[model samples]
Target: MDIRNRLKTTRRNLLGLAAGAAALAIVPFAAQAEDGVLKGKNLAYIAFGLQYEYQVTLVNRVKELAAEKGMSISVYDGKGDPSTQTTQLLDVVSKQPDIILLNPVDAKLLQGGVRKANESGIPLFMLENLPPEGEWVAYNTFDDVAGGAAGADAIAKLIGGKGLVLEVRGAIGSGQSEKRYKGFHDQVAAKYPDIKVETLKAEWTADNAHTLVLDAFTRDPNVAGIWAHNDEMIRGVVSALRQINRLKLAGEEGHVPTVGFDGTPLGLERIREGTQDADVGQNPFSMAESIVGEMENHFAGKPVAKETLIQPVMIWKENVDSPDNWGNRVN
Candidate 1:
């Protein structure tokens, strides 16, 4: 049997990809935290990089929620360095905050930190971005494979299922990078045989993505669509297009349609302007709220779910401005 036949991307499968983050779970049962663990309590959010727009958005949301609760989570920026994140995680663990929210820079590299958090008796929440899968205290995630598949399907449809598609992937060795690319390529190889995709590493940086796109198109201008793993990379792709004077809106004679993940306000606006075609909206805001809400539940001696699954939302120009349809804030 052809391997591709066995590996098919179904609507149902693609729709629920994020469920796997905590899906096959036997989360170790633990006693909930004591009362008043949330309000006025110190919660440390160890972020991978504050420079990322998505990370910035997460921090901003934390602030908004914190102000209302009369408490704030101490935010630590890893600056995209795995070692820094590991160091920060240990430092945060030493303080023994009421709860810890970790966005691991690199799951494997942060194992030591994970072990420390696990040993600290403090509740650790992996919101949206999951760590190397095993037993987690609590986790909430977007359907990443589903998100990637959605972008693939959109690009396929936009290019009429026939053309060269350049995949601008994120940092290698990361779970998301692998899963997102897998979902996309698997769908393309299975569902849209006529569509051909070429990949280049961007390391999830805009500069690298910008150069990668420019270089790819420079080598092959016949490319029809681009699938960026994140919206920041999409910005780089846009820059490349603008420089080559090939930047055109959707419906223009020869605009190379593109799709991206991460529903940042800027990204959504680009979609609204018809520069970017579609976005697989990862609901990090909701993911954050869901995971953190567990603090209160735990304080009440209630069992928090092992995993909270938030489905991916696909945004295009048609519904970009609809307040209710947003994955993140519109503004």
Candidate 2:
């Protein structure tokens, strides 16, 4: 053990330690690079329609998230037409994007397209809607049934569970619309026996809802409350009431309590203004996150849940200002 040999041994050990540390650091960076599998991936999102504020927000959030992840996304508006959506889905499948995200206007009508995507070997992800027959990597959607039940409970409480409440229903063949209608009816039947719901088909449009509400009020002036499947339809209800001089703020005498689904900015604003009661809110931002996360998982060869249901939030005047409410965060 000479002094020179001892010095050489110590220096060699130090070099070895430094090399090990450098390799350890490289490991993490390599893993991080692997985790970004979504980068440069192409995503095709077939939205149910961009006509509604909620759908628009959902599409925008997805786009933003995709951009952040260095992924590219193409969005197609279904225009609220099932046949058109079916055509678009087929066309998108032919393009052979890395992934396909479908928000169907009618689940049944889109099953063929879903099958086509499956046959093409393209991974399919569903948002806010699901078809009976399909092979989807993951499906992310809000609990429409729960949202409807919440709306029913809110309206029943406001109306004292005894009166003729008008229900502004959405499109006939839409799965979400059907679920909401069933949930509202079932909840009312099970809990609020004295409440009678009169149905009006609005097709998820403000003008249709406005016309229907005006006709209903003309037929019966004693309608107690209103529950709409969406905030857009509620807007129609508001205009019709105002035109007839029946609109009143909450706590005012003869104020008709209103409950709506989809916590759009208008819904939150009305809640703040005391013109609306409650909104069963489906967070589009959250839904976008869930779906995009699942897409990343699929690309990374990680396990993904077959279905993810983001719970609805009950937003009322008391909590409309909460930052967590998607309505408040929308640009």
Candidate 3:
């Protein structure tokens, strides 16, 4: 071929390559534009209750991230009542916000509200607890069942796999509470057959837990360890033990090894103080990140997962101070 023809062919190939590179660079910017569409959108978060530390932290983190994205959020507390949550859900559905985040106080009772949201075609995201029937954009929550099993294992190991252990349960009919109860019992029966667990319903309140634990101890002072559904209940358990003169530090005589779920700052503090032995840690911060990210993905026309379960971590005094723990990150 002639030299002129060869030069022309090389120039055309270079131009094509340059054009391809430029197009590749613009792709990310285009995606950024899509992601930024969340700005000015409205979100309604219906929390189970704000009284508990874990729920408070989760809701606060969601609000913080939503604010950073320039989104407006309205929060409603269910106050641990199914009726209240149902009312709030219906009201929020009527308003038809861009997105609805629901942490149901009772999943069964909220089915009607969920169905209404579905019929209304509003995007609904579930947190912690999922309604029995609903079409959700995504459900982001911790593995409470696994967390319960971890607590079982901790308590069993502490008591040498054979002893009486008291279980401070959350509210009856709560999905998370039921799962934790089932997980704890299933694990104990399957893996630690010698352990005996007596349950007391506390309704996820500190006062109830304190009273129940105190009464249980009075009836059977031979209890070796205790497992509570949440850190808040553990707080009551600690107070009860202290009142009964049974609150002993780890490695001390007569010390009742206590295990709890929810990696709240208070739980981590108790672990450091040696009163609480172990905690099944759930990363609410990560849950918040997932919630916000899923919202963005939905707005950006991306596919959202049906469910995302954040794994639970077992935290002991040995690793309670790790900054990776959400409890440690909270100010």
Per-residue alpha-carbon lDDT of candidate 2 for residues 52-143, written as tens digits (9 for 90 to 100)? 77877787777777777877677777889999999989999999988898999999888899999999999999987789887999988889
Instruction: Check candidate 1 and list the clashing pairs.
Output: 18-143
Ranking by lDDT: 2, 3, 1
Question: Which candidate achieves the best lDDT against the true structure?
Answer: 2
Score each candidate by Cα lDDT. 0.73, 0.84, 0.83
Question: Which 10 successive residues of model 2 have the least lDDT summed?
Answer: 24-33
Candidate with more favorable, higher TM-score: 1 or 2:
2
User: Where does candidate 1 stray beyond 4 Å?
Assistant: 1-37, 133-135, 325-331
The stretch of ten residues in a row with the least summed lDDT in candidate 3 is: 25-34
Tens digits of per-residue lDDT for model 1, 132-216: 6434667777777887788888998899999899999988867777889988988888899888889989988878988998999
Give a tens-digit lDDT track for model 3, residues 193-270: 889999999999889999999999989999989999998788789889889999888889889989999987778877
